[model samples]
Target: MRTTHALVQLALALMSAPQERHWGYELSKTSGVRSGAMYPRLRQMLDEGWLVDGWETSEEAGGRPARRYYRLTEDGQRELGALLRRAESDSRFGGLDLRMA
Candidate 1:
């Protein structure tokens, strides 16, 4: 699914960051995905055991309340590694000229 791919990209971005918690809006910005598409995928990832979500009460606002944060689960880390390896082996990406200037 396209959404799944986007979620994977989002997860990779989060993993690259030094911070532990990634809020919804931050993840959306980092992944180049809109909130509409990203949130449902995030919920699915949480249901699938690929991600863990929690609230940060200290950061709560008036009516909005706490923001939910997401982090990759152990299974998710392993899955990401496998997916990256597969992608690397695929000729579609392997043949690309990724050399930097």
Candidate 2:
């Protein structure tokens, strides 16, 4: 997929806690991406083998449905690093802002 500013922001956010599993809503909030954009981008990443996803399992939790969580794979980390570096040198992305919520 082509790298956009939003993609860079999301990648950075995921890399922020590379070892931790992140849920959709939390990722949306932290990455400053709306739900509409975040979900589709996440699915695209999964399809491209950049992300691994699974449902959260909690036995102690009251009967709530499991939430899907995502973690960046090794390849994802490498791809993100390259993308971020490219974006840093690209003047088009200079005006973009990534604010963590």
Candidate 3:
């Protein structure tokens, strides 16, 4: 995937909770990326097989509308880690700090 600031932020947010599931709104808040920019990036990640998504059942959501959740796949974890490291090294990224778990 092409590296962009918003994408890097999103990757960091996901890396912060690698094993936990993430949904759109929470990702937006955590990444500090607006929905307009975030969702399209998410779709690109999904298309690239960097993420797997599933819907939370209404019961699981406490009877609210079913919400979609995303998690990184094994390949995605490795790839994102590499991406973060690369971003950290790139002067364009402005000294990004990367320490992914």
Candidate 4:
């Protein structure tokens, strides 16, 4: 479940972004995860009804539109909170840096 924890941490970090929309590449870079790993995790989150994704046309970059954004669902937020609490309670995180942001 280490990957799952990483994925959830990535999602939480993304949620901290000021922008409402996030591109896949941006997420991958910020999360320190390669596209291969990030994309599958994202797909899993979507499949689990924990995320919503949408595409948008962008003229600034080029004629080609960027497959655009992803945001956490209400369920995702709830799950994140639960995960944070669990991690805080668990001794595995060393009980030093388990506080959730």
Runs in model 2 deviating more than 4 A are: 96-101
True-vs-predicted CA distance for residue 97, candidate 4, Å: 6.2
Clashing residue pairs found in predicted model 3: none
- Lowest lDDT sum, 10 consecutive residues, model 4, at 92-101
Taken over the whole model, the C-alpha lDDT of each candidate is 0.66, 0.82, 0.88, 0.67
RMSD of each: 4.6, 2.7, 1.3, 3.3
Candidate 4 global lDDT: 0.67
TM-score of each: 0.69, 0.87, 0.91, 0.70
Q: By summed lDDT, which 10 consecutive residues of candidate 3 come out lowest?
A: 92-101
**Candidate with best lDDT:** 3
Which residue pairs collide in model 1, if any?
A: none
Better of 2 and 4 by TM-score: 2
lDDT of 1 by residue, 1-101 (tens): 24255655565566665247788888888767788878887787778787788888764655676787888788766655565555555565554322211
Which is the better candidate, 1 or 3, if ranked by lDDT? 3
lDDT of 2 by residue, 13-88 (tens): 8988887898888898887888877788898999989899998777623488888899989998888777877887
Model 2 residue 70 lDDT score: 98
Ordering by TM-score:
3, 2, 4, 1
Worst ten in a row by lDDT for model 1: 92-101
